[model samples]
Target: MKHLTDNTLNEYLDHTSDERSRKSVKDHLNGCDACQTKLEELGKIFAELQIVPEVALKHDLTPGIMTRLNLETPVRIWTRTFAAQAGVASGVLYWLASQLIPFVKIPQVSLSKAVFELQSWFAQLLTIQVSLPTWQIPDIASLLPKFNYQAPTINLPFSTVHVISLTVTVIFLWVVANFILLRSRPQVQR
Candidate 1:
């Protein structure tokens, strides 16, 4: 059997060879020591090529990143506030236009006249009952069916203590927020 050439060995090892060529290469490698040694050397070279080192980043990028973030935050806040104000103004204008439009009002009918008109309409469709049912006392015990009852299990962890703690926290935070806002707001001068 002829031994596999370097080119044929490489094609076989790289999985680019046809079945007949691959079988020929395998058969040659089984008998030929020199071809087997060459294959082993190629395998070692591929193994060495597969090993990759973790690369360390070289630059201090924090200051540049912080500058970009700081620049973006204020512009984002201003745009959001402007959009919100524009939306509110548009809604107010729409509401005002709807309310002030002269042709939209229905004639002012009194409550008694409206009720009488509704009753008349009902009378035309069907007879109206203007009386209430007479009330009678029922035997309260007989009215209800008796059953073996179990008390409901309420598994509340922090009841009054939790509520009080939450209230105190909310109040403290509100006071702190208000103080911050007051300090930050520009004072109007006379």
Candidate 2:
């Protein structure tokens, strides 16, 4: 007859033992003082485990942050505007300089002369006499009409009439476009 084992005693304490095992442990506990004392110690240990508080970590994070942004600094608008104007002026000057500069010509043999030379060489190679015909091109500048201009008298208000005509044309086009857009829109069903 073996006395109550540690596992059986633990199971009995936890109320998980079968009826027969439970009765056997109870009977053994009633006769043994040592097993009863051990069970009381285990109960006290389990109760003490319930009272111990869990510790949480607290960190000082200010030292790890090495830099901060300065939000109070103001932007200089005049400096930026000056820089933009200087860039635009420089670009315009460069463009004007390029346009004013004369183009450089490279020394090259003319294509027409080269073609004539090639034909002459081919004729010499074949020992055949080739004679190219020359035709005279007539100048048409002498036939054009010549105009002699005397300054017109500023009697008519032509500039005012021109401005009025342009304004009327623009207004007419705008009205036509608006009418077309209005006619093309989808109608709602009643």
Best by lDDT, which number? 1
**What's the true lDDT of residue 125 in model 2?**
53
Instruction: Report lDDT (CA) for all predictions.
Output: 0.69, 0.65
- Reference-based lDDT, residue 46, model 2: 76
- Residues 11-87, model 2: lDDT tens digits: 98789989998998888888888888988888787799889998775976555432221233344445654577678
The estimated TM-scores of all candidates read 0.30, 0.27
Q: Which candidate number would show the highest TM-score if scored against the true structure? A: 1
Shift in Å, residue 85, candidate 2: 54
- Model 1: per-residue lDDT, tens digit, 46-131? 89988977888799899998777766654433455457767876997899677556434455667787777666655654543334
Error of 1 at 109 (Å): 75
Cα TM-score of candidate 1:
0.30
Alpha-carbon runs more than 4 Å astray in model 1 = 60-190
Worst 10-residue lDDT window, candidate 2: 143-152
Residue 20 error for model 1, in Å? Answer: 2.0
